[model samples]
Target chain A: MSQGNMNLTLKVWKQKNKNEKGRFETFDAKGISPDMSFLEMFDVVNEHLISSGKEPIAFDHDCREGICGMCSMYINGRPHGPKQGVTTCQLHMRSFKDGDTIVVEPWRSAAFPVIKDLAVDRSSFDRIMASGGFVSINTGNAKDANNILIPKYDADDAFNAAACIGCGACVAACKNSSAMLFVSAKVSQLALLPQGKIEKRDRVLNMVKQMDEEGFGNCTNTGACEAECPKSISLENIARMNREYLKASLT
Target chain B: MSEKSFFLSSSIGKKISMGLTGLFLISFLIVHVSVNSCIFINDGGITFNAAAHFMATNPLIRLIEIGLFAGLILHIIFALLLTLENKKARPIGYEKINGSANSNWYSRSMGILGSLLLIFLVVHLAHFWIDTKIAVFTGKADKHNTFNEMKEVFSNWYIVALYLIGVGSLLFHILHGFQSAFQTLGLNHKKYTPIIKKIGLWFSIIVCLLFASMPVAIFTELIK
Candidate 1:
């Protein structure tokens, strides 16, 4: 390894299933290469766990590439560990030094109940989406992408909102446990799209209603969600959502 | 629990309360500034004092005052609870919080600034509300002249300075609070987010400047 080697003490959460009681179990990881990804180090730890008659700490992961938005973990005290815009799988051990004591936990929102160990059931995100995330485009109603001819400004704005991956990191990071950023992104993405114009009012109304139903906290404008988000989603989305809601309410 | 009733149970409900209460308080600021501006219209403070006396006694105004008190209490309570929850949520700070550089400074310090503003509110109510209420109840002011009372209060340079600093903190808070309240209500579309944010900033600055100007003008003898 080009980077120096290091040892770490891991306090990993272990739960058998959603209903199971979980606790932190300590493990010593020595001979870890600093360049190894955080998940890679986890892999080494898991290998040791399996060989030592222990169940490996189960976690949710799909794309180690940070794009899947599946790697949700509270590293030290931050969501997706400490590295900005990087998932836990993408974070390298080089960010830490030898003999570091790493504390890993799951997202702590009431909306995000733990499924097991470091994995949380983020289906609340899916529910919020199902309430009103997409345009009501029907089959055989295909339209040319450029036919709508949205202004460049609107196009760019929609793209920024569409970049949200439905991760619950914002909820995890917000002091109020607010999901305004996520709901606003969904509302904004469609509101900006030309095809979404037909249902803009209904879209915001239903999504916000569902967001409320899901038990998310109100946004206090603290911006912790934006600060900790792996996607760098802007708080501007929340402002847009507010405008949409106010307009919708008037109608 | 019933799904429809879960709004109150959800994190989103807490946010909605925070937003609504915050916006409501901002409206109170507008009224307060307007009433305070009456002082400029009356150089001898007679007209302003009469108006202030009328406002203090009006039934409608009293009703709204109760609402305002409820709003302030809820705003502070929820703010404290939210801060504590957030602290418990992320027990450790990040190592390299990437993209944090992109967020606005006001957005990050909502809690700290809010606390300072809360402290300012306590002193403000004590200096103004308590004394005024006491005077109103006792009918002790020279013909119920609240403006004279205000003049006495603002005559102190330290009091004026404190009001200026307090309003300044409030301005900083509204800069973030206005937009964030909307976001909490789930208003996250991009087309208008930037415009709302700009409006929030300008609104904060304008209102704070106008309110702060009262004490400043009084202290400088510009309004005498």
Candidate 2:
């Protein structure tokens, strides 16, 4: 009820299943509270839908904390609406003014098929990660974190790269559909860590190989992924990934 | 899932093909720039014209041209297909982006800049290559050397202006393309990555500017 001062229209994508034809259906959102989170606003709309005996729009969401990255709606032409570094769940109704039109839809990628109205199958990302994401650390003994003693610079870089949430927003924002940012982040994360250094060459080669195999486009270096990423992951990671791959190839 | 199976897929194959072909095009620009520098020699116009003529008529060069064209076609096709796929992959834009200082502006505008370069290439080929090659083969052009045709075309102000703009855009393209192509090839590293990127930028700028100067000199009557 915090957004009660504003009136808005919601143009949301609706689909019964993956094979179902989807369309944007509009709904009136009046007396919305300004303090309501985007998801909370959705709850209000769904309440209205349920009361009217309408099938509520199904969207992927979990943790609502932005770390889980389960919220994958593209709002108003941006991955997480216009707010930078905020996930859809973290976005508040105050981000918009009254009488604004909000367009919500799921991620669109061949690799990510729509499961329903606003939910998509992001399993391709899992497959990409499974390709070569983790280092082969022996699980029998728990080593102290201090034992690694990686350079400060390397640790920072690795941490930055690891910040990627496996959100497919970068792939969507890219004009060439390049996943260089995502793949590079994964490659760089492991490549920077000492544990990851052992299989650095193989890891980068395999992940890049998997990325290409997934039918993602070549990295045209458009930097859109970096721009659109909720984590604000740098393109430098992609550059770093490139450097690792080249070294791997030569070795 | 397996490495063997992964590399064989058309997507991977196409990306590899694009990376290699793009690298080849970069190399061609270097060679083309070197040849174009002959305009500065002032050897009674003999040296430059001879080089130009050889490029136009040499069998080996023709073979290379075929490869170049193939690379160009594949690169464009793959680029288009990839864009369409990416469009499908992320129908929605992200809500918040964190890192912006990590990449150069040129790196972000590669697609738009590349399309511009492609348009420029078509115009360039039509004006220079098609005009001369087709005219020569079909007996429409007089028996003047290819360099003379170039000179005549370059003498026009509009042609000079167009060539300059094309070359400027190409310079921008190469600046980003050189670093990007390497990244696509998975060449990121801490020790030597920055060095390679700097080299890529300088190479692109110098080569593109060198080629661009030829038309400028001709238009200014400095070559005559």
Model 1: per-residue lDDT, tens digit, B1-224?
11232444444455677889999999998888888888888578877777777778788998999999999999888777766755544443333233353356667677878888888889888877887788768876446666666777789999898888889889888988898776767665557778988988889988898889888887777777
TM-score of 1: 0.72
Model 2 TM-score on a 0 to 1 scale: 0.76
Candidate 1, superposed: residue stretches over 4 Å from native? A1-3, A141-145, B1-175, B178-224
In candidate 2, what are the lDDT values of residues B101-178, reduced to their tens digit?
334666666667778888888888887788668765776444536667678888788878878878887888778777
lDDT of 1 by residue, A41-151 (tens): 988988988999988888888878877888888778777777787678888998998999998877777677788888888888888788884666767876676666789
Chain A vs. native, model 2, TM-score: 0.94
DockQ of each: 0.24, 0.28
Tens digits of lDDT, candidate 2, A1-251: 44257889998888899898888889888778888889988888889989999888898888888898788887877778778777888899999999998888777666678899989887877877888855677887888879868899889988988888887777666654567788878888887888888877777777777776666666666576777788989878876776666566556
Task: Point to the candidate with the largest TM-score.
Answer: 2
